[model samples]
Structure formats: C-alpha cells, structure tokens
Target: MIKVPIIKLRQNMIKKLTTFALILLVVSVTALPALGEDDENNFIALDHGYTVDYYKSYGAPAIQASITGDPEFERGETADLKIKIANVGVISGFKRLNANQKRINDSIEETIALKEMGEEEEATTAKDIEATLQSETKYIEVESTGNFQNVEELETGHTAPLSYTIKVDGNIPAGNYELLLPVTYQYQANVRTVTADAINLGITDVDYSREYKTKTEVLKIPLSIKSEPKFEVTNVSGSLIQGESKVVNITYKNTRETMAKDAFARIIVMSPLSTEKSTVRLGDIGPGEEKTASFEIKAAQDATVKKYGINSEIKYLDDDKNTKFSESMKVNLPLEATEEKFSVTGIAILLIIVIALYQIVNVHRKRNHNNENVSGDENEY
Candidate 1:
C-alpha cells in the first residue's frame, strides 16, 4: 500500500525466493538418506529370501551284516564263514532340493518341532524326510577280533561278501557266542551354497556342494558252539528190502573235545520201518574217534523205494558220572525193490501149473480106458 522503491521491492522478492530455495534444499538432503536406507534394506531382504537353511539337517548311515553260511561250530575245530554286508540308510535324494522345496522343508521342520513339544493339536504332519533325501555311502570298512575280511565302497541295498576263518579253542564251553563287527563309513553331512543368482526378483540359479563325515560303530553277530557229547553219523552201510528185515551198520564219530564214557547209540524208527533192537552199546569213545553200531530194521511191504531218515541220539556218562542225552541226529537208509525174488517166484508158479496139468491128463486117459471096456462087455451080452 505505501509507495516503495522498485529496486527495493525487487531485492525483497529475490531474498524471499532464495530463502524458499534453501528450505527446499535442506528438506531434500534430509529425506534422501532415509530413502537410500530403505532401498538397501529391501535389497538385503531379497538376497536373504533366496537362501535355504534346511539343507544342513541330515542323519548318519546305518550298516548291517548277516552270516551267509552255517553258524555252528565244534570245539577245537576251525570254521570257514562268509558274511554279507548291507547299508540301510534311511535318508534319500540329498542335494536335490530347490528354493520352494526349502520353504516346504522349513514348514515341515516347524511342524515337527511343534509336535515334539506336545502341541499335537496345532501341529501338521509333513512328508517323510527319508523320501526326500537321497543318502549314499562313500566307503565302508569292517573288522573283527577273531577273524574277518574287510570290504570297501558298499552301496545302498547292495551286499558285499566277506570271508573269514576262525579256530575254536578246546576249552571253550558250549553256548551261544557273540561276535562284534566294527564298521566304519563316510556319509554326506550337509550341502552348502557358494553362490546364487536372481531372476525377475526371484531366486533362480545356485551353485552348491556337499560335505562328508565319518562314523564308526559295532554290530553283534551270533554263533553257536556244540557241546562235549556231539555226535555225527557217517559211512552208513545197509540196504533194506521192501518186505524183509535187514541188518544195518552205521559209523558214528565223536566230534567233541572230551571223551564220552559208557556210551550207547539209540535210534527211533520212523514210519515205513520198524526195529526190535533199537540201541547198541559202544563202551567208550574219545574225542575225534569213530565207532560202529549195528541194528536190525524191517521195512513195510508197501514201503516206497527211496531213502529214509532214522532219528538217532547218543546216551553217555559225563565227566560227573551223570547220564546225558545228545542232540538228535539223522541216519539215512535206502530201501530197494527185490526184482530177482519176484522172477524166481514166477518160475516156481509156472512149474507147479505144469505138474497139475500132467496129472489131469493121466486121469482122463484111465477113465476113457474103463468106459471102453464096459461098452465091449455089454455088446457080448
């Protein structure tokens, strides 16, 4: 309203514009740092989202073994045995999970944890981890205190044969024995990501590798040792005719480490065969000694022509002077048909028929002579 100089007015307007410009510059400078910080945080969150943490959790390998042959041994004897080794690891498909799989795995882990904490109502069951991870064995080693052969690089569900020879001590009491087999192997521990790439703000490509570790454990295997009265039947000599009684001689060997005193071999005759003398006395048998026993056995008339098994055992006086019975053993005897006897019976039957026919012809001739004489007399009258 008051008249002012034009130059002063121009100065005032410039000053006001300069002050507004300064205020704008200050505001811009302060706000720019916060925006930059927010942008950096967003980038960091995206990078973290692309990484998977569930790949680090995994279990060890489980190895098992079994005997491939007979697991029985006698005292003071050497046994040759074979063993089969197998890897039964529960995990499978290792190092094959993607980012989405990782997320699913993380969710599964959370569910498992909740269930473990007794929150069953709130927990969800996840897919089995054993089906998700592909497990493998890098190498395997085996050892035993007695005798064993080691194997290497055994695969999952595959078996490797190991041979061993062991000697049983003479004084070892007869019982079940446990043999410990120490097994060692390496297995994949965890997979690590070295680098990763992004595509359209998503995790797409990654370079990773696996780490391995070693584990050692012992497994027990069972075996049996025979007692002091062990007996085995060998060198059986006899043939049984289908309809007749025959004498059989069986050779028995004492495979024990001690002597059996006042010993007798007893047999139980099975079907299709019968025996009156079921036992034979063998005075005394020492370790690794053989003795023979004879028995009279009769086979049934309708018995099949084949080998038959006789169950037999040994009764003897032990070192304590007490009577004991050994385990049952099988004795094999063969029965055969007597075709030559049948041929002889057939010939005898044919001879008897010829004699009867000769007698009948002689009688018929005599009767014809008598009838002719009577007819001539009647004509004379």
Candidate 2:
C-alpha cells in the first residue's frame, strides 16, 4: 500500500473556505473593475507613468483549488478530473500613505488620486495564472499532457476549472489521495496616479501606474479510491509447447476487501494462441482468497518461441446480482519451441530398414561378379 501524504489543513484556510458566501458578496459588489479601456487612449505609451502614492493596500491574491465534483473513484478507472480554483482574498484593509483630507478635500487632484487608489485595490485579483498539477504516488498517474495550465485572469471569488486526465492503479488500496496544484500568478502590488502624463499623451485619463508582484501557492486536492474487490494473477502453471494443446492452470487472488460472488475467469486469446474453453467457473472469491482455474489453450505450430501475454478478466455478480467485469489482467505464458522425438520401437524399425536395403545391394553385387568371372573362364578355354 502506497502511503498517502498526510495533510494538515491550516486553521486559517478552513475559515476562509467557509466564508465563500461573504467572499462572493464582496467580489460582486467591490471587485475591482479592469483598469484600462478597450482603445489606445487609456495607455500612456511612455517609459513610465507619474506616481501619487496616495494609499497602499495590504492584502494579496489568495488561491484555493478543489475537485469540482465527487472525488471518490473506483480503481482501474480513467477520468478527467476537473479542478476549480477561486480567489477568495479580500483587500484586508488599506493605509493612507500621504492623504491630508483637510487640505486636499474636494480638489481635482484628490479625485484623481482616489481614482488611482481604485486601481491599487486590485491586489486581490490574480492574473496570468499558471497551475501545474502533480501526483506523488505511483498508484495514481497524470496521463494527459500540458499538466501546466494557463489562465489569463481570475478575479477574487471567481472560479475557474482545470481539466486533467488521470489513471488509477487497479491494485491501489482504498484511501484518500492528494494531488498537488502549484499555482503561480502576478497580482497588482502597487498603483499610483499617472494623470500628469495623460495630458501629454493626448489621452483622456491615462489613469494609474500599476506594479505587479508574482506569488506561488500550492493547493491540495483530495481524491478517494473506493474500496472494491480487486484480483490479480498470482501464479501460472503448465508450459505451452508449439503445435500442442495443454491445460494451463492460472490462480487468481482477490487482494481487496469486497467479496466477488459467482466469479468466473475469462481469457481472451488472439492469433498464434487459441483456447477451446476461455472461461472457467470459480464459485466465489472472498478477501485474500485464491481461486485457481484451468484453461485448455493451444499454441499454433508456427507460434514464436517467446513469452506470450494473454489478456484475462473476471466476470461476477455484484451486490445487486448485476453482472460486472473486472479490469483486464495479463497471463504470461511461455511457448516452448517444438522439438522432434522418437520412441524406441520406431528407432529400431528405421535401423532395420536401412540394414536390409544394404544387404540386398551387397548380394546383387556378389552375383554380378560371379557371372562376370564365368564369362572370363569360357573365353580363356
């Protein structure tokens, strides 16, 4: 069993999560509007803008991420996990940097300075967000590419979803798992008035000079691997010789908590390998119980002499008597190269045939020689 990282939720974070409603209300009413306009008029287009330093804000963007739907999942499941990110940070408070309300009251400069402070209030708005999702355990894997996601902007109390494809190990135990999402983004750190340059740039109100700072925060997403009956091929018996049929014994053990009722082992064989009986009945497989099923599989004569991985699964009745199939498992069977062999009687018969043919040829040669010798003697006389 792979260990799940023990997470210690910060006391402060729990309180912030519970204040979603308040955050939503404040974001709806007081969320800072975008500082610039659509055209080129709002941009100063200069090396720098003038500063006012009327006020300074204290809070920063606070990011929170969570799985959007039910986090519970079954083993051997592949799914697209959607994560929701929200900025729940508020402007905590603001300090008067150089405000002299008695003297600057109702002045044109004062109005412009306050307008600039509105831009400064955007410290809680996160921008140019990049979130990278990661997994620590081998039991769960992030399969999809681009695990690093980008978001142009996410304001306070506004949520955004990130999609990542993941695969769960069939043998992973039932428990809570944590996925880490480290998010980096820039937020408005300081803002100042740039009204002095607005006139020179021919813009109505170049408005504010904005300064940004980058921050990174990691958010933990919790996922539950559901408890269920899991099976694996523990042992394989019998060798497969080419051009011959053999009964292969495969033992399957339920490694999980749930009991598999009326389970039947089913195997799938492709070319070069064939099975007359693909399925064998295994009455019941309880927790940690091993069940062996014998399948008669034949290897073709031309089959390669290598380890063949045959796919197999389990079909069984669930708690409601509904049929369910387990994830595909591999049955590694070695196919031995065919070799020729002869019995003692067959070898003896072959040797006798060879000897009899040799003796007959020898006798024919001897008779021919004697006839030749008789002809020679008549000629001599």
Candidate 3:
C-alpha cells in the first residue's frame, strides 16, 4: 500500500470541503423564495417567477410589442402597416425555471441528496438540468384597437407581424404625424407558491392564470406628406445674350382647383443674372388659366453658355387677404453668343466702299482706251 503524507491528505480534504460548500451555496440561492409584492413592483424582473402580480396590478401586459411600417407616408394615400409584437418579458436564465419551476426544484433536490450521500460526483449534468425547465410563456393573446385587429398565442422570443390598412387625410400638413395604437392582451400573471420538499430543496409552482388589460401606446411612425403647390411654369419665350438686357415673357398657370387671387411672380437673381423687374403683377389667375409676365433681365458678359436655373416663386393673396407663397420652382434660361447682326450704319458704309471701287475701276479703263488710240494714231503717221 502507498504511504500518504498527512499534509497532502489534509489539503485534499480541504478542497473537497470547499467544493461541497460551494454546491450548497448554489442550491440555497437557487431555492430562495419568489419575489415579494414590494420587490416585484419596484424591480422589473427578467427571469424566475414572482409571487406578486406586478403586470396585472399595474394594468400592463408582460408582453412587449413594437410597430413597424412604411416610414414615408404620403397624404391622401393608403398603405399597409405592420405591427411586430413579441413576449420579451421573460428573463434569460430563468426562462426555463419560470416554466417548469417545480420540475427544476425536484431535480435540484435529488442532486443535493446525492451529494450528501457521498455521490456528489454523480450529480445531474447541465443538459439534464436544462431538460427539466421550460422557457415558453403560456396562454398569450394580443389585440389592437383603432388601426389593427387581434393576434393570439405568442411564444417567448417569437414575434408576430400584424398588418393594417390605413389612409392619411388629404388636408393633413406636411410633417411628422403620430398615430395611436391601443393594444390589449391577456398573459400569465405572476402568482407563485413554494412547497418544501426537504431541508434544503423546495418546489415553486407558477400559476398559469391569465389576466386581460389594455395598454394605449403611441407609435411614433413617421409620415411625410409633400405639399402639392398646384402651380407650374408653362411657356417661356425670350433670347438672352451675354452683357445685354432683354425682356423675358414667362407664362404662369394655376393648376389648383382654387383661383389664385392677386397673383404675382417673383424672381430671385443669382450670379451671372440680374433683373430690374423682379416682381410682375399677374392679377387673378383662375384654375387652368395661364397668364404671362414680362421681366427685364440682364446677363453678365462672362456668363456661361449653358442653361442656368432661375429660382422663382408665386405670391398670391387669398380670400382673407393673407399673403401665401407657392413652393419655389426653378426655370431654365439658356444663354448663347452669336455674330454681330447687320445694322443700317454697317450697310451704308459697305455701299459707299463699293461705289468708290467702281468709280476708280471705270476711270482706269477709260485711260487705257485712250492710250490704245494714241498708239494707233502714232503708228499710222
């Protein structure tokens, strides 16, 4: 037989004792009583069943849900909306414990008893412990008011998408709008009972009874409706030359159903462009009616020979005499360079030069004829 040193033996014994103490501590902590009423109300428990019904007492469901749909919504347009709901109330590690608390307690008790009987090495495996617990919530149901309908039986960590068809008002302002999503659901409230099985082990039973409550939550779904200014630039006629001033005729049309009273066209001048007449009075322009406005505009000599955008807006006085401006729009103006055109002074100078050249040529021809005659007469003599 091998001789064992007293120091080595004592060290081995101490290690075993320490390990046993740790196991006992884990079991004691795991078997602690369910949360009390005050603690449950104050703390948002993520795992393990609680004896106090916090959600039901506060008229809130334990299930957490969210809404998702098209972020861009246009006025007077109908669209489909989706609301995604999930039971996110269950705690992570305690999911299984909450579901099969009694079964887990039984397993823990058996393991502790085995350890006390010198069979600690044969305790339950991690897989066996997990198998004894369940993480799914029971009897889950949800319903939506105002814009949606009912949804039922949602499991933990599982999401359900609810669809709805909604339309935005035509006259609604162009901005972010919020819609109310009143949700109602029935879920298992926290009602637990603990029963002692032995000195260090107990079984916890969580009631599967459900309670109903409605939660009105505001879903901040973004809706963007663009303003329809119902105005357009119809006809543009004019020629623009670098370093020259010209009159431009622009036709404005009121495309809206309502009439544009005391309408005027306003132009914004930028680089390479200047306008003496910026605003033109168009009087009243009815629906589908067009009116022309003449503006005196000048282009810089070094302006680019390309199309330039002219920013312009239409200001009108409504029936209440309130001045409202239509959405600013851009009109393209083309600039081109061309050869100098013929003028009266240029034509007169050309005619004078032609007459002078003709007279000189005629006089030279006469002199040549006379010289020829003189030569003939001398030869004859």
What's the TM-score of every candidate structure? Answer: 0.36, 0.60, 0.46
- Please report, in order, the local distance difference test score of every candidate based on alpha carbons: 0.64, 0.82, 0.57
Query: Model 1 lDDT vs. the true structure?
Result: 0.64
Deviation (Å) of 170 in candidate 3: 14
User: Each prediction's Cα RMSD?
Assistant: 18.8, 20.1, 14.9
Expressed as tens digits, the lDDT of each residue in 9-88 for candidate 1 is 99999999999878766744543333333332212222343334333343445667777878877666666667676666
Model 2 TM-score, all chains together:
0.60
Can you rank all candidates by TM-score, best first? 2, 3, 1
Distance from true position, residue 306, model 3, in Å?
A: 4.3
Clashes of each: 6, 0, 1
What digit string (tens of lDDT, one per residue) describes model 2 on residues 1-381?
A: 975444544665677887975766564333233335453222322334334577888888899988988999888899999999999989888777764434345586677666766776678999999998899999999975958799989889899989998999877888999999999998887876554544433434445556777899988999999777888999999989999999999999998888899999999999899988899999989999999999999999999999999999999887778788888899999999988889899999999999999999999999999999999999999
Residue 41 C-alpha lDDT in model 1:
21
Candidate 1, number of clashes: 6
Query: Which structure among the candidates has the greatest TM-score?
Result: 2
Compute the lDDT for candidate 2: 0.82
lDDT of 3 by residue, 187-259 (tens): 4333322223333433233222222223333333333554333568998889788889888888888776667
Cα error, candidate 3, residue 269 (Å): 3.1
